[model samples]
Target: MAETRVGGARIRYDDVGQGGPTLLFIPGWCTSRAVFRKLAPWCSTLHRTLVVDLPGHGESSLPGMDFENATVVDILRSVIDASGARQVVPVALSHGGWWALELRRQLGSRIPALVLLDWLVLEPPPAFLQAVRALQTPQWRQAREGLFSLWLQGVSSPDVIRFVQEDMGSFGEDMWKRAGREVSRAYAQYGSPLRALSALSSPVPTLHLYAQPEDSAWLDAQRSFASSHPWYQVQKLPARSHFPLLELPEEMAARIGRFIDARVDVGNPLDRLAPSPS
Candidate 1:
């Protein structure tokens, strides 16, 4: 676990392996780099892999930095510039995917390649965000509080769950209570960075791993965006509820390995080996 001070936040990251085509792994919000423990090693066989913990999550610190200006994109660009890696691929899940698009918008043709998962957009319009903001009912609170379980089911290693229960118990009420506020702030107040997703004009090798039928909206939207842009590949994990990385880290890592390897053409060891998604 290496920690660096990036723009007033103590960003924690895990860097492993040694090879060309460095990979930056970004997990979903509130989750730690530990989620990629299994996947990083697989990527290491062919590429230098680094998984980072976003601020306010994992071992990273939360700063009062403007969330809109110093967004996930800023943090990632800073990491790339600071890492001294000439070019790197971004493999992001959930919120990480949203930020990756922003990076594409910021970096233009420099991005090595992109791999996005399930929920990657700036979701919820102003009115919808406002509506969720007004949900103070016990039922809504309970549902929000339980979002962790639903999310974790995708990537819950035994150790990962233990770590959350022991170290992040305080996050339960605290996180759910503020989820709506943060969403609204990022969506409405932040000026909607999601438009950047459909606006990416780069020709980088891109792949989207979607949990089929679950996030059909996001899947369809990104696919549509990709269709009109550079060549992109889409892998549908049928019936998979969001969180392919957590729900099946081995499969996720293997697939990512194959994708990166296929892009680089060195014959990725994980290629054609992943059990076909059900």
Candidate 2:
């Protein structure tokens, strides 16, 4: 376990293995590095891997700070710098994709590739929007519980269920409220993950792996986006849970390995020194 201080917050992470173009795993909102326990260790065998417990989540402490995007990115930046990684591939899950995209936007060529796990990258549906709104009200706990029920619709594994319940249930009211507001703010700012990636000045090779969408239209939208953007690729895995990384870490790791092997040239020196966005 290694630690980096951003502002007064102590961001904790697990840094394992040794190599260039490290894989940095970022968990979803309200979750921690434990979410990537199975996945990150597997990837670490092939390349350097850093699994972070974002401030206010997992083992990290978020003293006197809100769980906003800029602060999270700053902490992530500190982790990368402290670990001395010249090139990186951010494997972000769910809402974590927001910070990963922002990091790529800030760091540019230093991030050669990106992998998103089961994120709602297109325009959120009315139901999702309503849910986010509900999360801001006094009944936020109920709203969050409802969202959890929805996410676990078809999940049956005891391990996965316990993980989701415990981790997602661990946050306090302030953190949960901040999570809701931040998500709403991210959608307001970037519209969607697709739009966020599109706004980038330089293309970063990206692979989005999803389990299932709320509807066929969502899947089609991602397919359409990938078809138009050469830098983006989308794949649907045989998964039914929202937390696919927890449910299918081995499979997820294998798919990510193949994507990196095929898309990113880890040996290319120029990719490591790619200039920051102007």
Candidate 3:
């Protein structure tokens, strides 16, 4: 475990093993780098792994600012810069994939490839954006505990359920409110990650591993995007839960390992970099 001071926030991460192209892991909302604890070792054999805890979640500190989408990108960039990694393969889960994509959008070719694990991507309609904002407010937070836990029970394993419950009990109020507020702000401001990625002129080589029984909207979006851009590919994991990484770590790691091996081994090394804007 290590901490880096990125501006006012203290970003915490676990740097396991060493080598290249560096594999950076960004966990989803609510959970921290701890979520990747079981998965990192399998990947470390081939690539250096950095499992990070974004601000306001896990062991990192957010200081005075809110954790919006842009801020999330900034934190990831800071971590990459601090590590002196010239080229990277970002492996992200859930909402973390949005931040990873945003970073790739900004840095361009510095990013080599992306592994999206059951990530949610949608431009979100106007009504949905409004609804998201509404859910972010204090009123929703006041009424969310039971409903949220129940929702967790339906989608996650007993371990994940326990983790969520414990996380909520320990860092529930601030983390939950801040995450919801920031994600809503991101959708309202920058639109959905799917929209942003779809708009890219050159597609980043992406491998999306989604859990079975996925969100239809996400499936539709990724399918549409991949159909047009051959560089993108999507596969469904055998598992049905939201946190498949936790439920099936070995299978998840094997799938990720295959993607990393296949995608990174393409002929021209330069092809891995993002193309310059036209």
RMSD of each: 7.1, 3.9, 5.3
- Could you tell me the TM-score of candidate 3? 0.83
In terms of lDDT, the poorest run of 10 residues in model 1 is: 269-278
Better of 2 and 3 by lDDT: 2
Measured with C-alpha atoms, the lDDT of residue 77 in candidate 1 is 78
Per-residue C-alpha lDDT of model 1 across residues 1-278, encoded as one tens digit per residue: 55567668878777666665678898765566776766677777766777888777778777553354246667777777666555567888655665676676677655657887765353455544544465334555555546545545655355546544544344444444454445455565434433544445645677777663465675676667657865576777743345455456667667777887677542343422322111
In the range 1-278, model 3's lDDT, one tens digit per residue, is 76788668899887766656678899877777777777788887666678898887778888565546677788888888777666778999877777888878888777768888875565565644554465567665544565355447556477667655675455656666666677676666657666666666567888888774445766776788888877788887766466677778887778877777777654444433422112
- Write out the backbone clash pairs for model 3: 109-274
Backbone clashes for every candidate come to 4, 0, 1
Ranking by TM-score: 2, 3, 1
Kindly list the per-residue Cα lDDT of model 2 for residues 22-133, writing each as its tens digit.
Answer: 8999987888888888888778767778899988888899856455778888889999988778888999989999989988889988888999988989888889988988
lDDT of 2 at 132: 86
Candidate 1 similarity to native, TM-score: 0.71
Number of the top lDDT candidate: 2
Error of 3 at 101 (Å): 1.4
What's the C-alpha lDDT at position 274 in model 2? Answer: 39
* Model 2 global lDDT (CA atoms, 0 to 1): 0.84
Off by over 4 Å in 2: 65-67, 267-278
